[model samples]
Target: MSNPESFRELCRNELHSGPTSGLLSGYVQANLLILPQSAAESFEDLCFRNPVACPLLCKTNDSPYRLENHDRYIKNGHFDIRRDFPKYNIYHGGELIEQKNNCVDEWAEGHVGFLIGCSFSFEYALAQAGLAPKNVVQGSNVSMFVTTKYLDTSGIFHRCPYVVSMRPYKVNDIEQVRQITRLFKKTHGEPIDWGFDGAQRLGIRDLKQPEYGDPIDIAENEIPVFWACGVTPQLAVATVGQSIDGAVVGHTPGHMLVLDTTQVS
Candidate 1:
């Protein structure tokens, strides 16, 4: 499962359905967000307003199930948006209604698919620096939390909290981790904050209870490090509430779509 094409085939055929971290190393991974065509423009504006959490890679309004001409990021010709992701979350009226292995039955003609930059894309570089995330080392999904900090609002999108992914590191190793991750500008560059003080600044009360993904145990000298997460959009959609007329689709937390390109600059 080292090759992106082969890994994608497993996803397409429903052979591999789990968190995508630590697999397909050296390749870029993306978070999927499929929105109704009517709200696509506003949602794009939201992404523009909040680039750290939602750094958009590429988007298409042509086909909901496939990417025909977009080869720069996703080089696989057989890539399908509906079936390539390990899991999908379906949201209606700002509430998650169902989780599915594939979105083949949920996607429609006017749906727009967006590929957002994921922090998972930068994990390979961290491992290269001997700062691999504990979640990757433990074979679990990264812990994610909805912070009290609010994102700058766009048209029809408001009152959304900034979601952050957490990783634990020794107090001394945090500086090196920050230095290494800062190079990945496209995939949530650097740590927004580290240590327990950092978590409090973001209004997170408890580290044990995460909104999404698994919680990793923190060692004696280690502290929780937080980063902007792609799941912010899913929270945004939920916070926006009844403003959206139709259902929204997104990749499940920690599960991402692997792209062929390795360039994150």
Candidate 2:
């Protein structure tokens, strides 16, 4: 087995750039969050309520930046959360902003850490179904968008809308797409809706102007399909709670936490 800490150091050393899609190969990459104790309980409840966006993979018992993964941390003497991740986004007073690679100094004992399953888990399932993602198709990041919809009331997070990712495919491939992704319920299960009409319902109108990822052409006989993206929560973290009254705190959209688990298991 490879030394996870060494890999982390290497990622930080030089190659720790760009999308990590094919880098880890089979690891269960995750969406991350570090919130104050006041909102942690509500956030967890929101995650449980809307399992699609917030899968609720794992959480730390105490201050976020200071996590004790025991085994992983022990195995690597240098298991510092701040510098470990290639990048991070900082959310303060509900506003978000990108931070340099390290944010450990900003950590307070009151913060809590959260990790959620990512759609990356189903990449194999997607490939197995013969419907490899187009983001992977065009060698770019996945396209994401914010929606007007909101999850049922839970707490501070209940007011946000579900974010979604769009992929164009032939009508013929739709069935295979469903059958394959349906099996990965722990991840983002079957498509919530299909075709361009559904895409519009999700607040993603421009196929060419994706918030992320390059636009892939839609075949004359095909339509754009939508999936309940895990990135939804991240987008919420990035866009929610921003008011024009001099309150614009937010986080970056694409950055996610990479988990210690691997999909190749």
Candidate 3:
């Protein structure tokens, strides 16, 4: 489904359920994190401290099941946060307990929904620059890894490591890829590191074994490029020592909420 609205409808109806990468090519795709009001403030602060990993787009107001107030965040009036996502992970005391197609039953009053900008949002621009991500080309989910490097702690959210998404490119094309992705400030602006040495610097021991999403093959001359991923928030939710009282919810890795807005300016 090329159209975002219709595609969203399919998701809403539970007709579509899988990774959303390369599906809605030009539209902005967002990572969904729904936290109880008790944890919302601290999580927001965590995002503020780590903008590269969690570029927050907009948050819901009083409505727990719908995104409100932000015009650019929601283009469809009927967009339901509970049902729009392809899949949701329910975490209890930092452990994933259940996966659901729709989180309507899990979301409670006073819960706030945060939409984090996704790296997938910039893939169209990357393709335009002739630097399309390897996962997109191979019809697979982007490779994501939980790095040894930790993010700055914020309130109850601590001990969270940096989760990075990887894309492969030729050694010579790295500079051009950097130039193109830098324009997308809201969608994880630029590569944090590139090349094999770069991946080693981030403490990634193996490129093939990713914590989330499918691994893409790196060609002989191609090098793997790393970017801070929106999935960092999920890692934060899981690793935080202070257990959240209520259930913490997030979009399943590689499955994202497709937004109606165009590429971030």
Candidates' RMSD to native:
2.0, 4.0, 1.8
Each model's lDDT comes to 0.86, 0.63, 0.85
lDDT at position 250, candidate 3: 93
lDDT of 3 by residue, 1-265 (tens): 7677788889999999988867867788988888998899998898889888888888887885455555666665577888889999988888899999999988888899999898877788888877778787787788899998888889898778999999999989988988888988888889999889988899999999999889789999999999998888888888872478988889987788888888585
Cα deviation at 59, candidate 3, in Å, is 0.6
**Prediction 3 global C-alpha lDDT:** 0.85
Q: What's the residue-level lDDT of 59 in candidate 2?
A: 68
- Score candidate 3 by TM-score against the native: 0.92
Candidates 2 and 3, the one with greater TM-score: 3
* lDDT preference between candidates 1 and 3, better one: 1
TM-score list, all predictions: 0.91, 0.81, 0.92
- Pairs with steric clashes in candidate 3: none
Q: Per-residue lDDT for 15 in model 3?
A: 98
lDDT of 2: 0.63
Q: Which stretches of candidate 2 lie over 4 Å from their true place?
A: 1-5, 11-17, 63-78, 238-256, 263-265
